[model samples]
Target: MTDLERFKNILNEHREELEKEYSISNMGLFGSYVRDDQEKGSDLDILVEFSQPISLLRFVSLKRRLSQLLDVEVDLVMKKALKPRVGERILAEVVYI
Candidate 1:
């Protein structure tokens, strides 16, 4: 399989674990992997929103879970919801799951 195909397959294999570990209610694949061809060793870019706040410890824990499942480097950029939008961490970048 191609890189993108393998990447997607890896994601499919870990969906349940992702949701359970991260408490991610809204998870999606957006950006290069979804639109453009992924080069070898390219990152799996995803966007995820948890129902509750995600602490640093939780982030690290989730990353470990993904790593075991994929056996490939996984980068998780978790975004916690903050109200008013005055000062919120930009969620523009993609996060791999």
Candidate 2:
């Protein structure tokens, strides 16, 4: 499978796990993987929107879990906490799942 397809599968798996364990409202894929510009070491950039505020510890733990599952680094962004420009950029590029 292509990298995007692989990443989408990984994202779907993670999304299921997250939904089972957390109160997330939305989830999406962005950045290099979504753009089809990822290099060998490009990390997965995921935007997660939670129904309520989540703790740093939880976020870190989630990132760790995703990284381990995908065998690549994960950059998790809280959708509600993004700056205006960054949010705009993410919105422009994100492929929701």
Candidate 3:
């Protein structure tokens, strides 16, 4: 499968797990993975919107779990905490799942 396809599958898998364990309202694939410009070392960039505020421990745990599952680094951005520029860029290219 293509890298993008693999990335999506991993994302979906993690999304399911996160949804079951947390209160995720929305999630999307962003950055190079979504833009089709990822290199071999590119990490997965994800934007997540939670139904309620999540603790830092939960965020770190989620990132670690996804990184382990996908066999790559994960960069997760909380929708409520994103900077204006980063949010705009991610929103422009993100593919919500």
Best by TM-score: 2
- lDDT of model 3 at position 85: 88
Indicate the residue-level lDDT of 93 in model 3: 88
Task: Assess candidate 2 and give its TM-score to the true structure.
Answer: 0.89
lDDT of 3 by residue, 1-97 (tens): 9776887787676776688776788988889878788898888898888888788898899888778877889998888887898778878988887
Instruction: Kindly list the per-residue Cα lDDT of model 1 for residues 1-97, writing each as its tens digit.
Output: 7555676687777777777777787665544565566566766555567877778898788777666765655656544432435213234433344
lDDT of 2 by residue, 1-97 (tens): 9777887787686776687676778888899988888898889898888877778888888889878877889998988789998789999999887
TM-score, per-candidate, Cα-based: 0.59, 0.89, 0.88
lDDT measured at residue 5 in model 3 versus the true structure, 0 to 100: 83
Candidate 3: residue 71 Cα off by (Å): 1.3
Worst 10 residues of 3 by lDDT: 8-17
Candidate 1: where are CA atoms >4 Å away?
Answer: 79-97
Model with the higher lDDT, candidate 1 or 3: 3
Worst 10 residues of 2 by lDDT: 13-22
Looking at model 1, residue 4 earns an lDDT score of 51
Give the poorly placed runs of model 2, Cα more than 4 Å off.
none
